[model samples]
Target: MPPAPASRHRTGRRTHGLLAAAEGLATAAALTAALPADAHDGGGHGHRPGRYQDVQLLSFNDLHGNLESPSGSSGRITELQPDGTTRTVDAGGAEYLATHLRQARAGHPYSVTAAGGDMVGASPLLSGLFHDEPTIEALGKLKLDVTTVGNHEFDEGARELARLQNGGCHPTDGCYTGKRFKGAGFPYLAANVQDEKTGKPILKPYWVWKKKDVRIGFIGVTLEGTPDIVSADGVKGVAFKDEVETINKYAKVLQRQGVRSIVALIHEGGFPASGAYNYDCDSPGAGAGISGPIVDIAKNVTPAVDALVTGHTHAAYVCTVPDPAGRPRMVTSAASFGRLYTDTTLTYDRRTGDIARTAVRSANHVVTRDVPKAADMTDLISRWNALAAPIGNRPIGYISADIDNTGDESPMGDLIADAQLAHGKELDPRTSLALMNPGGVRSGLTYRAKGAEGDGVVTYAEGFTVQPFANTVNLQDFTGAQLVQVLKEQVSGANAAAPKILQPSAGLTYTLDLTRSGADRVVTDSVRLDGHPVDPAATYRVATNSFLAGGGDGFPTLAQGTNDLVGEDDLAALGTYLTAHSSATSPLAPPAADRITVVQ
Candidate 1:
């Protein structure tokens, strides 16, 4: 089923190029300074008498285009109950999300729907098959007003992101649907992202939302270190700026335009101690509860900004963090996928055209499957699935049980490493073992799912979801001493604070002693290959993904490997390994994931 071009009920516009759009935003700022917008005489915008108006701010983040309900851990969220217990609630899916957002706006008149970036990329087969055109159509139907740009928005590079923003058939795919792709209804704001040649923002820096003279300004910024996490090819000609400085710069611009109420939609966030969305950071020890780059960013951002909507860390929290001026401002994240939606109410001060900071209330709400499936989103999913069926429905392999990536080490990670190892060995017969980055494993291999052909069947779509990066299996030679350093770098250098543990295949093992500090945690004597202690002076052929070969995810020592040999794409290698090794009668079981012996 070739996708029919999405039928449009509304036409949207994008602010392309920095110079002209920045000028437009500057003019908006000047107008805001001159006029006391949203002024009310102790009455509504109309002649009717009313108190301060309530502006409903509905926000979510990291939607990775999960049109269908996700399976395994990714599809669920933790909810702390009233009785001090926590329950795992199955959440997400654009179908239920649409219903929830629509029902949430039932009585609110001054409502604005927004997102904190990652609205696409790393998507499931349904949306990814059509280049996420379905997700954009769903956002338009959901009435999303604005959103920030996320690093994933640049996954296919700036040119593709522009295509998604403006309108066009994919340059390669031509047109999957009969209809032409009309980009996002909401602007993908990127205040800090600048063109390398011109030094101006590549997209709109900010967006102004006005209704009945009530104007709320929004400034969007992705993480400052986007270049480090994304593929080098994607960010080759783009430059990312300081998050705090960029947001503060745009916040002042909004204020100068007389827009007193400002919200920063950031694509970076902090981690929370508790998995429960309602876990209160207001508790005495909540400072310890929240950590990561966003903590410092929230502290330093301008006090003029009213609130912050954030993502990237994929943790959910509703907390008050004081800004530089010591004013308590709300900072919130709704986790990843379509699992959560943050419902915030802001009291709009008509006289000042600003948000009443003291009256702000926010909380993360689960998109429970109990709600009726939104018909429009279901139709959208069905349409995309029909188009995706031929290529996506092919059975790839069989699983005896779910192979998941949940903790420091995961079965799925080990499986990918093993697959890469086999492919690498085929390329260079002397390849000793393989390694994998935890972030590269996108989702788990679930044994059972809601819409599957069989209990243990893995489809081409599921395989694609797991290995969407399209990295190749790379073989290289490294001295045993440098190999030890590679393990140490997982916890040292750029990864000192947030250790990015590398997943290793069978026949390679090491002891990670968390009781020690820094590089000392990697016990040199315990590093072994094939049950033999690795000789410091010996050279060994190793297998890993191209990302690791290029020093991605802070493992810089891997970049020093000599005699590079690139093999098959990691996805195909994994699929081939699965098919060759398993069948319905003898399905693949989850790897033991015993490569790293961790001592706490």
Candidate 2:
């Protein structure tokens, strides 16, 4: 299918004639009950005479292009049992996801699949090697109807994102399949992302999924703070607006156009009370059940929007956050990496032309690996693997055990920081320490073999998965005062709510007091390097990725470093460090992750 057509006018500001034309089109479309050829056969329920219509909405998010089954913890979903214990279920993989989604839509003809975004960034080698074309094609095969754009969508910048939306091969890489890319089969909504010059959405702000008389409008928006997280170059020409304002504005547009059944696809999400996919957020006395930016966004969204499908925090929850009108509305998120998918039933009230908010039901289901794999998805993965195997299978180094990226200070994060520091030392012997951003460490290195690579062997593909952004290892000079400020910044400013603790390398130790809040969390006097206190007047050279050097996360203080010197790609530095530090006789063991002394 061709890409969805772009809107000629700005959303929420259309001319009166345009609004009238839209209303007329909507009315004409609603008068017919004929199901399109591509529409699912709702098991003879298409013509059922009822006051309300049940529309199945299957949604997932933050699929970072693990076309195959993800390895390690990334592929598992926690399931809460009746006895109150939890068990880990092997989940994720496009193959199993396709099977689950197809099964979920079996008897529901009005099923529409959507996503909350991050569908194609920080991807595995199979998809990342080809700029996530395989994943995009797989999304099409899954029959996704619409999605919002996550911050990772701008990893390669707006022009690349546009190419992914529209059809074309990479401007530099050309066609990997020797055929022209067909882009996304569904519309990507970006109601909040606007062009800096024109003040219009970068993509279609909203998309309407029509099935004869059943029409559901979807408005998609990423977090307004997208610019702070993304690389400067990635979000250069676009501006991200407030999520609530953007959704509210487009909800009115859909209402004005006579399409009242609306769902807001928000890319920002909340932290649920529990990690289990089956956790009951609405249980008695669970209170809000979730917290973070999504709480306010969901509560303030106009009542015109019946439900919200959210992601980014990668937490799972199905609960009601009352809308502005004080009516409880569904808010949900399926944990990231396609491990879980939320199935929601929206009862469309025909008379009111809106959803029966009281009848809305949603739950997250794990994409269990036990199901029969979708043959087409398996074939797609095989094709991509065949192409990627040449580069992906090459052994980079060896590991003694799994270096998991979990906890406040992960072993994988420490290893990465140490690797980058070694690379920095090569460029300049005076480089003192390295700090790695938590978000940049995508996945952990599992010692077990994922492919043909033997046990304990680390392949280039695995390293790439851990660090996929192609960020450079950069060296910068900072005085002791500025360095201390950088550490404090991790808990202050934008990070105050969600502290993004930077992983510290060997010899850089500090005390983190959880009892305190904000900058005080970093014990000022306890900051040390190689057993020596950090003198306020001393200068130190630090190594960090390009993202941190430019203050990408919430560490704005890091951007103040002087004497910038860019080195090799961060992944290459990791590969070099692993090769030099490990061998068949003596493989590298997981870092102890004790650099930061935590006092809770």
Candidate 3:
């Protein structure tokens, strides 16, 4: 369908008046009795008194402040095939996302756009440089009606998040542009994130999207395990509660307020059996195709909640998992980085003040850039680019070729580890080695420069994309034995099925024997440092990001280290190392990732 007339729609920069639902039906009638008693039983094209109203719930998640189109592998999505294979599609970028969303909302008058969170944080230089103000403004223009607080929202801490919502110049950086930071027009709901001292949520726990007579209560929550992933400073004075319990508690609150139709914007998700967004997780033969905490949350959550929109596990899927009442309910997630948007039809019953669950349908559509980019979004990007150009365009280093984070071990991960290791030793000479988590490597460093800089030049923006998390390079005291346990933790415990192998710096080597189960896979005899067997009883100084130092990413052993000495932020270290070490004549080459000898 073509878009609504330009005059009928408002720029994302203004309030989304058309998307709100009718609020509060005082008559209190059942959905079955919603139809008028005198209504004729004849078929007609016009809306019948009893027919349910379709409320379009548009959602996307894990945007990570991608104002511009993403590059390399990060910009592509895998599509499932009937032949059981997969094909990659290039998608995402704020400009095109806006057009697709506006077009999708064209014919639907009762539509609300929401997000599952991770909208900002770990952002690219263009957005991250301005403290994600550009992204917030861009999202505002995109008409993000509502969103939850994702783990990345806490990257700079609760205080920063409050600033993002409440409007203000960065306390330190102040206002970057002539325009004042007006915060978000949309509310950031954080039902599960509570203040440790006050015992209340850090932000508004829930939000009600209201039109004249219809209301839909939205309860937003970050993952309960958020503390485990974000830096310690980010969650210093907050407590994360159980997702199911928080949602159940708020569902009752919403019910008491006469808001029967509810949606849970949860920043937690699961994996699909197939990579395709259309994969049928509910198929009898699918057999636990969609698996994760959301499954349990869906099964145990009070049936009062009608739908659960989730993120964080970035994969996309539109599935129905039975609720506590054994009634099938919608559960959805759009892939990360704005590549896709999910369109969920929530059939509302005016009389019953509840949703017709059976009629609910959801699907994820790619945000293809083939169409014209939204003029407002394009203007927003252009304005921000002018301000970010100087700093973002500076050349940091040169690379021979693309350094990608691939498979069992990645060359890019090793290079990052080596950089961190070098930076760590400069801070504390005793530091023996450094390790980089696979997930931290956001994108590959392309050899063909993205900007006007020479072919092999690495622009500051490119480097920021590769390592967006503002994590500090931390050094801590750990015994050789503890280090070994840390390596084992990669493939054991919570990571056994999905191993998050830590990329190590030069001089550190080990054999990963997949034939052996769990911790035994880390061949102890093969563990070496500078060609010497690492002594278990000997004390050593290990280096890693602050996230790992605090036991993030299931590596509990790393948290056992003592004598913390925080170094420079990881991105700074990478930038400095690249600037000081690489040149055009002799550019840095991708590491072989041979440190970890994998044996099947």
Candidate 4:
């Protein structure tokens, strides 16, 4: 399809840099005095009548274009009950999310809806088929005030992201609704992402929301290591700067503008000690219950920023980490897939133009399905589903039982690896084994029918949901020694902090010892293929997705393989494998996921 005729909009709100230095210096001095005291100590004076304003900031992250209810574990959230036990609650879907946000905003005239990033990408067929135009449109209806760009926003590269922000029909797919797409209604902030050549931010670095003197400035940034995880072409010509430095720099700019109350919307987040959405991460004191990169970034960020809204790790938490001055500041994240949302109360001190950190409070709430669906959202979903039905409803295969994507060695991951290996053999008969990155396998296959499809039947939509990245199954040749190094890379180097386990095909097996650390975690002596020990000097053909071929997800060794030959799309390969292996009468059963000998 040709490019849309509509011109692109200019980059976000800009401020003059020529503001008087003396005025800026004076403003900084005032800001220092106006800011809140030690939040953990609760030192602020009692709230005076009409002196403060309660600003309701509702936030969520990683929607991932789930216009409809997500299936399997992706649609559930753990809830800590009064009985001191946890229970899973069915949540998510744009209809329910819309209702929850709208209901939460009631009675609060000064409310703002924001997101941490990844509003789209790796989506279900309903949204992904139309290039996520449905999701962007749904967000506009959800009243999302602002958001940062997550790594997935670069899935199709910068130009595509720009088209999403500025209205236009997809260059190739064209408009789905017979009308020009009007882009996103809210600003997509990218404080740390810069144009390499010009040293300028590609999107708005910061955005301010003001309702009669109640002003709040937001600085958005994804993880500084975005390039390491995203495909090279996705982030071409752009530089991801240090998160702490970028946020701090923008804090000064907002401060110079006399916008004292600031919030950092960061795409990088931490893992809380507890998985329950209602877990009080701050109960153990400040940020004791959570630990990850967000902790360090929060601790190092300038005290000028009052709070941090974060995502990416997709763990739920409402914690507080001390600022540079050792004063407690709020840090929060909502679990992904529209399953949960964090509601934060920022006590805006109108007199001082800053938030009273001592009065800050936050909690994550499930987007429970008990409530009635938002009618408008229902209409929007139905409209898109109608368009998607033709391609989505077609039967692709059958399953005997649920094949879930969970734990270190997921059944779904195993299935995908086997499918890729089969596809690889078609391109190169010498292909011996296949390895799949856990991140690429998005969801699982359930035997139960989701729509009109009968039990055990799998539709093209379900398969697309499971493997939506459109990565190619590529074949490469590698020495056995290098293959061993690739396995070690999963637990060491860039992936040391959080391992990215590579799922292996049927013929390949090894022992993973959790008791060990780093590269030693992979029991080298236990490595084998087809019951034969992997000799260091021997050469073997390996099959992996194009993303892994380019060294994504901390697997740099995979990028070094020689004689690359790209096969069919990973999803197509999976469909082919299913059709060849099973039928309605004899459906495929879930893999045991017992290939890896895990020893604690």
Candidate 5:
């Protein structure tokens, strides 16, 4: 199929017209339906026939504000073959993505663009510094209708997010009016998120829209653990409710109002399948299996809801599972940072006021740079780049060596860990070795001389780009046994009997023998702390960022630790630590590797 057209579909800075028109049209119908509180429920003044012939739902999740393409090698999403070797694919960025989304929207009478969550926050400097305003603008040009509140959205707090949605609190130019920031042409939904006192969703729970004869409902929800995951200050008064309950309650209301078709835009996701990171619906086998709270919600959500779109895991896939009614429930998620586009076709039955079965088709398409940039999207990204150029373009720091992501042990990973340890040590004297997770390193350090431009200079902008999530630094005390358990998770699969043991950061290193089966892959026999054999019964002070400490990366061990020091934003701590101790003079050393010894 030919690629989708670019945002250039609409020209000029006055594009808000398109957005306002879309929302005005949708809201008008909703207000009309919501009014006359006495209107016949379901029989509402003689079931005004449906409007839309068929609706197309185009979604992207976990954008992380990479309005421009990002640099760095992601995890090896290798398809472990029968022969033991693996195949890999590189993914990411937004410029090339516009073309894919445009293509995905073709032929549908009413197509809506939406994102599950993490569209911003933990963003690259180009979009991060302006508080991800550029991302809002980029998504604006793309014509997004509604987005769920992901954990990352609260990085700056509810007030700041509201600023991003409506307008900013400051006199700054892009502070308030979302138009100024390139926000989606629509409002954000928080169906499961409620204010502590009012008990109503802090943000609108769901949005009802009219297209042709169809009354389509779009409901948005963030993960229930949002408060626990976001910065403590960002979610002070809000409470995330049960996803299934929230959706069911709203689904019933929409059903009574004669709205039958529903699509959930949520920010939670499942586990990686096999060893590959990307997934497709047509692919054979189970694809990747889902875990966590989302799986339960998707399985139990009111059958009235026709489709569920999710994000937050950042993996890609298009899959289906049976809902409460035994009907196939289509669920999908695009990879993070604008690397993939998820398209789901929702077919509504005009005659029965219901959604058609097997009519739902969803797919996750990779966004490759090889494709020509849509003229208009390129222009949108260019304009934002121009606005952010001075700060993002200016140099701040430089690297003396190349931090290649060839293996588990790399200089970049070590540097990140050291920074975390340094930050943690200041907060608590007990902090000894910092354990950084590889998933947290978004970019790599470039090796360059004093004047080499592309030589990979590590600047302040570059630093933030590497660790953009802003996860706080946390201090914890774990018994050597628990610490070992955390270490063992690196090799655990999502379906593994125990927690998946992902790689840990440097304290003392040892070899990991993949051949050693399950938890045995962690060569605990060779593991050490400060060059001495670790006593499994002993306790140790471990320093890690809040995400991992909070049990992100599937490491529940961190959560069970003794002292829980909160409030240290990882990115801030990294920046502060780097500036205080290092200069261009600091030498970058690769984290020495004794782990992962592959045998012939």
Candidate 6:
């Protein structure tokens, strides 16, 4: 679909720059004073009564724990063009985004800023070394109203996740204990996350914030499959519950407590396309990509729910689906990692005891570098960067080449897969090939100039920060036939006929013909073992991370594999491999593309 007309707003160019610089300097002064800003919605110079009568809910998701400026990742991201071809955009770093968020909130009354999830794990060196406390402090400074739980929150288990939210559980000498984090002004709600023993939810179900007479309720929920997708050890005791049931249960409870308007902060999303599947916007139902469980929840959630704010799939969309009452139910999501924020305005009807559906209007804000940073948020980020300077900035090793993710065939992904294959063979020599999910490579590696500066550079603290979630390595046995099925899974979408199996790493070679569609596109039947064809019935040990071993990224064939050899740390394996193989040269090699083959 073509982009809608841009909103009308005008500001003096040079004056805005000067004003932004002044704001940043003032924020630095405020940080030194340790005096936080009182919560004030930039209203249109007046007060209002009722839920969403004059309220703005500002939200962003998938922050990934970037507390300071750091190198970002690569990909061919599309920018919805109003009239021309969809333009490509680069993704990354939070500073430029913080600038944008603050500026966007200028002059909006009752504006509540929050996140969907993935805020503080799989971080960069500047924040992850201290267990994402810096990011926490930054959020507090930003005055976030609420946030839902994402799967990465379980990186260090429930205890650590709680520590990051509440306070550290360990003593002062422990890793995350002494860090300074401004506790959230609003609670972090995990309505569906439950404790197995008590059958009760783990965190607060919802938060009710009143700006004068307007009562706004925010409910948070993680995806039901969070535990399964996370590393087994990371979430051993906790259980994720039915999303729809949990929301319905909580909506009534909040309503009973006198909150009339409710919005779901769920860490789940739909896939959306403009033209064709995974292409441009040309069809209507593309906004419905966020299917499965979330679809059921959206359609059946109680009447009290005014809007559904969602994430996790990292797809962008905005549309109104129908609730059970045939009422127009608004569902919106900003694409992941601070890329976009869906802006929706809700109007409360005084006569009818519910939000006016026709009065609801929504738009997505793209976090671009063009905007200026809010003073308070920028200051908070600066303070955290100062605290993390000594630990994160220290050097660990060096790389000569640029670790790029600019294409489907990413160098960083290849490097990670190589690490998996090398480490898997060590644990069990039966391992032949290692498969990695593209979504798992959160950040890229950038090597500094040969003779640049400090001794402690890109610390082990940094590398792990790049691959923070301690996903275990698993060695599973699979027949050549099953492996072939795995390759076909990649082109299952409309691109299926295009023969694009995304990009797998070295030690594997494959071909794909763009003309064919779906499974048939993977036509070449030859399977190789060290440059020789192998029997389709032959069983081979396939190496992969635990998440995929249990069937993550739609790779079900991995679960059927046998002889699971589990190793605790995937990041540790990569770090060791990098240090041992550091010849000041890039360790990644181009893919052989063996597992997949296609013919036109």
TM-score for each predicted model, relative to the true structure: 0.92, 0.92, 0.89, 0.92, 0.75, 0.78
Q: Model 6: per-residue lDDT, tens digit, 1-600?
A: 111101000000000042232121101000011111322223344653332354677777777665544454422235544354555554334666666666667766657776788776666655665666667767776668789887777776777677767764333436443544444455778899887888787788898867655677888998786764566566768899878888889989988887877888988765454411123221244234334345667788877798888776655556566677876666766665565565566664433444555566665655554555556667666666666566545455556556654344467667778778888878887778887766566666655432233322345545654565556778888888888887776566422322223335455766656476566555545445566555578888887777777765555666788877788577777776776666344443333333444444
RMSD of each: 8.7, 9.2, 8.1, 9.4, 10.0, 9.7
RMSD of 2: 9.2
Q: Candidate 1, residues 157-253: lDDT per residue as tens digits?
A: 8988899899888887778778789888789999999999999999999999997767899999998878767778777788999999999899889
Question: Is 2 or 5 the stronger prediction by lDDT?
Answer: 2
The local distance difference test score of each candidate is: 0.80, 0.82, 0.80, 0.84, 0.64, 0.61
TM-score of decoy 5 = 0.75
The lDDT leader among the candidates is: 4
Worst 10 residues of 1 by lDDT: 1-10
Candidate 3 per-residue C-alpha lDDT over 1-600 given as tens digits, one digit per residue, 9 for 90 to 100: 111100100001100022111101111111122434432322246645343567899999999889888887778877666576767777899998998899889877779999999888778878888888989998899899999998889878899899999998888887887667999999999999999999999999999998545689999998887776666777889999999899989999999999999999998887677666656666662215677667888788889999889988787777778787877778888888898888887877777888877667777778777778899989988888898888888898988888876666788888899999999989999989998887787777888756689888998888887887767889998988998999999888867756778889999999999889989999998999999999999988888987788787789888889999999878789988888888999998888889999887
Runs in model 3 with CA error above 4 Å?
1-50, 285-287, 428-430, 494-498, 514-516, 562-565
Count of residue pairs whose backbone atoms collide, per candidate: 7, 0, 7, 1, 31, 34
Report how far residue 140 has shifted in candidate 5, in Å: 1.0
lDDT of 5: 0.64
How far does residue 500 in candidate 5 sit from its true spot (Å)?
7.0
- List model 5 lDDT by residue over 124-232, tens digit each: 7777766777787778777788888887777777777777787543333334334343334678888998888888887788998786566778788887766544545
Model 4 residue pairs with clashes: 1-172
